[model samples]
Target chain A: MPNGLDKPETTLEKIERMDRRIVFLAIAITIILPLIWPLGLPIGVSPQVDDFHEAIESIPDGSVVLFPNDYDPASKAELYPMTVAILHHFFKEDRNLKVIGLGLFPAGPPLLQKAFEEVAVDQYGAEYGKDFVNLGYKEGREIVMASMGESIPQTFPTDFFGTSIDSLPIMQGIKNYSDIAILVNVSAGYPGTKEWVQQVVSVFDVLMVSGTTGVSAPEYYPYYNSGQLAGMLEGLKGAAEYETLIEEQGIATSGMDAQSLGHLVIILFIIAGNVLFILNKRNKNRDRGGRF
Target chain B: MWELLGIWIQVFLTLAIFSFLYRDNPFYKFAEHLFVGVATGYWVVLQIRNVLIPNLFQPLFGEFSDPWLVIPLFLGLVLFMRLSDKYSYMSRWGMAAVVGIFSGLAIFGFGGGDLIIQIRSNVMPFIDTEAVQAFTQKAGVITFLNILSNPIFIIGVICVLFYFFFSTEHTGALGVVSKIGIYLLMISFGASYGNTVMARISLFIDRAQFGIVNWIPTVIIGILMIIAFVVLAITGKVDPKKQF
Candidate 1:
């Protein structure tokens, strides 16, 4: 070749610059195939999950469990199943629960209400304001939490359905964090389990556990190690494991096989892409007399 | 019937968004615009229903007995002053109040939770009996793991802190430890990245499940979309690459 530009591109170079559409297609296939006919891979229980389960199980029947649904539709795919599974466990144990939302502006409360309606009310025949109460979404994140820490009645005067707290049978003995046996925070992002820890649990000396997104999981490990969080569920895997513990094959369990297959596809792609990149670089170096 | 229609619309929208995998087109553009519009509208409705009516409206006029409710009601209204050019500065009062309260709260909240507790927790005993007891199920393997883990945590913390300690230049032993710190930092970062990748793929799997579980509606809408997209592509009415 007369010039570098005149030389024909190597196979590695061609592969390196290949259209990204093909990669997208491969990802699409990997996720879809497993869903259509699942591999049904076993989901091993983690020590963290075992701890979480034990913490909940240790609480006597009819103990008031504080559950904060702190996520939006964007994270519904990851966090929603966990919400249902936990509610199932709570109702199964006949635990008195209060579900609240201190999450995003609009999206959090309805999901909490829906979970209550489906799992607690319909499935378990839980009476409204007797078995569970939905306190709804409050505007201030940590501020609302801090206020609740001080006084639950002062922060939320009424439940989500516009019923005064005075009318609710569930709120009779519950005044603040002290009344709650355990605080279970299933969170997606900010003003979530971390915020709850900082604002309420540490202050009140309440036992707390969290189920957070996969990305937020590693960040909370220190808190878990420190005993700030008694236990935690990390993302969908956490949810699946929890579902397994409860012996209910819920949505999280259904998605686990697909999740495993998707991860495998991504790892394979990363390896293949790196190999091609290295080959292309070596070829270029050979052409340039090993200097460039 | 209405629920079925809603599901069909959802199916169409999902396909529309997914079509971008091929290339940018009008379908993707429509879906994108529709999502933003719907989301914004939904947010507005929820705020009014959940926040304003229940918190502000009911307390003020509807069977509310508290005089203290007026204070937050006034402050919340002050937050709306940003809409006016002349009164926008008044919004600062509301903003300042929020900042002041949170800052005061953070002194104890963030400081205690993140700093004090974290630091205290890291001061682990050189020999932890609880850890030893916890690992005793498989005595040999657990002992090895406990030994491996305890030192890594302590040493990693010390070295990483040293790496960040720029008051003095890293030299000799400090330099070597700092280099070790960098390795430890890389391992932590690699773990985080691997977990994040798993999370993202979980999201993809969810969307795929949605499509598969609702195959009939999704496939019907998808085929209709493909035909419409192809006709537009052939006619040069939509540029698949640059339509968005």
Candidate 2:
């Protein structure tokens, strides 16, 4: 029994060396099940997301909300839902609010256009170049934002369609950051919330919120704590929370049950990994006659 | 019909990329190469459409008294000089201008906003009553959690700062403080990892919804992939012993 090979392999040993494909398969099934079969999961709203919702609510009527739909297709799973929900909330018939949609990332516009079509066009029947203006993709990120503080028209001379900004009714009197009420940066990081903080919020003192990927959420807490960021919506959870606030059971809301189960799987793995590691370590130490 | 074709293409690509989870194969490589190529092609076309024509060409040819714009235009063009050995020196002119401008911009932007403001804000009351009030504004257990968390925040900040202090050796009280800092860092890292896991799961869920909701194309692709894998295994192209 003192020699490891003399004894049968323990359950720990067998499970520890199990092929990782099993875990992938497990995760795939758990996620796919919820997608196929609808589970009406009750979602709780987080304080940060509540703050983000309130920030939007606080935007005065007739004021413009600059929504920077700044992310690529890769982030579509998380950020795309947030974009749809936010647009749905913004273009609500009662609000009478205008939004200037733009992005630093090139891929963002097309996706934003999709959101516009789905939420703004179909649901709200919002007119193009009147209710919302897409500035397309700007190449310069921080520099472009900083320049935007000077003049929005100068920063972007034309709309997404190459139509002159002067002609678009939405662009009328929207000179700079000062004219804008609040900016919601739906970002998947760099040249996003951070850039907006530096170039616009810090410099021009623009009120802003950010809906970012889960990974970037921790870093923005300090900004949220400092009151620099008005609100924070982090990842799919944030999207679901925002959807809840808007009273819309969208894609993110449906994905919640799956997200929770996947998290449970990870937690189980982490606990198992630590427990097995410690036990195996002790066994190995005993075999070595107490040598570390 | 076009929409159906698009969906089929998308499903094929998704399955091709997803097959990598099983093992490395030509399908994954093809999808990867196609993605990179398409992305590069998109960026080039976008840059020309957005930048060259609208910002530079349209302005230069359309204007007479635009001396200010000409300087930037010349500097941008000179950046290509690096390709030629004889004119390589001219590239530095463009590079220097860029570096200098960015450096100046960043100094003010980052220094004043992120660094100065963040550091200043961190130096707050250890037990922030206002933050407690904000938490309490919303009902439930979060209020109690916020009350406990308010003090730990400042402590976490201090301990983490202490851990990074290499000028003085960590001994006595310093060691104890830095040791706490290590724990705080581990907690932060664990949170980050948890978030990353959630992100990855969400991505998988998105794809699952895409495929499962549109079951026809997905079923077709899934069968094809299984067949291809079976064929590869039978042909001895992918040695199972070597792979997994």
Candidate 3:
């Protein structure tokens, strides 16, 4: 009974029941090493991100681009790079950027302020009142979105920093959704892209694009296909792709080698698990006289 | 100097949270509580400063610019009454107003966006020779791939919708299409799961970047944590097996 198959069977069984912590350690190492020393794997651009860049690029220069800063610190790792990359694109192209944070009220406004300061103002030398404006966070969720469709200044009379809307040079000639050329949303979760689509994109004729959390991306494919969203960026991969499109090597791109390696590790683990399962099943069948 | 301090704090917290990978301990508990407390506090302060003051307090105090603002302010205050036993009933009026307004808006939004527009978009030409011609012109090929895509899309949509039709039992031809629907659903779910795994790993990679690249201090902190863990385990204060 202690034959060639039986000897290997014990090893397979051991692997099948291998300690989970070992697996966790492998994953941790797989992610960490690549991150410490990046391989710079080329990320293939998705048609969706291609469309997202094109949507922003297609808008005439100096036209208003209204997108929300709709995520917080929890999702900063994935969404922040997208935010920075997109903002960089907007500023570089000389677009009149109007930023807002209506959803995730408490979390998004401060992050949006930080993003604008870091990307739009500090990096691009974009004049605040003239080139871009931060509408800041407002509560009311979908209701605020609906209201913005009606009137921007009425919904937010003052910017996040307390500057009156009338005083901002960028506010000139931008009265409603009609004046806005495109709505680009880099969102994390609910009351984010879907709410915007329902309240703003569908109600008015504003062209919409979104960069959402990876988990929420599949459900939104319908919206993307339907033209409710002109283009979409799904999670960190999408963000990395956008950064590539803009010719900037940011955090998202830096993390991609780690991401690729991590994904490979997971897939290998899965394959190993399946092999173990199959071997165990075959051994059980052999024990049962070729499964009756 | 301030930046270094910030980096050190981040390292400490990151290591503290990662310690849970080993076992539940005081460090993990401390980090979790601190994260929740700080995030909640930050959110509340931001809402008050950015939203409440500028939107509500300014309008109420500075001028009676829009009297309708008072109505919402009253309703919002009434929401707090639920914390008390006797006045909890008064809170229902505010709750009802909120529910009623939201429901009404949702119905309108859903019907217009989710129902009509979504349906309209799906109602494509089953066979558009024009589209085929345009693709042929653009790509310089008379391939049937463009024409074939439409029929496949239409069939897939119908079959998937049919699978969700619970009113009738799937039998015979219906059963076959329903099986196809299940396959389609599985394919979509598998693709989605792949995306989710990538997203989650990216988060971990970001944390790794923070610990290893942005702050080498965290590696030292991580080592110190491991020593503490081992010490605790040796003293019988922790059970490493329990984590497994």
Largest TM-score belongs to which candidate? Answer: 2
Pairs of colliding residues, candidate 3: none
lDDT, candidate 3, B90-182, per-residue tens: 899899999998898888888888899888888888997877887777764445666776787898889999999998899999999999998
> Candidate 3 — what's its lDDT?
0.83
Q: Is candidate 2 or candidate 3 better by lDDT?
A: 2
Q: Show the colliding residue pairs in model 1.
A: none
Global lDDT scores for all candidate models: 0.82, 0.87, 0.83
The DockQ values of the predictions, listed in order, are 0.68, 0.72, 0.71
Task: Compare candidates 1 and 2 on DockQ and give the better one.
Answer: 2
Tell me the tens digit of each residue's lDDT in model 2 across B46-163.
8888766666766677654455788988999899999999999999999999898778878888886789899888786667796578776875686777677757888898899999
lDDT of 1 at A159: 79
The numbered model that scores best in DockQ is 2
Regions of model 3 farther than 4 Å from truth: A1-9, A95-104, A289-292, B127-148
DockQ-derived CAPRI band for the predicted complex in model 3: medium
Pairs clashing within candidate 2: none
- Candidate 2 chain A: worst-modelled 10 consecutive residues by lDDT: A1-10
Question: What does the lDDT read for residue A8 in candidate 3?
Answer: 46
Give the poorly placed runs of model 2, Cα more than 4 Å off.
A1-11, B63-67, B130-141, B241-244
Kindly indicate the candidate among 2 and 3 with the higher DockQ. Answer: 2
List the candidates ranked by TM-score, beginning with the highest: 2, 1, 3
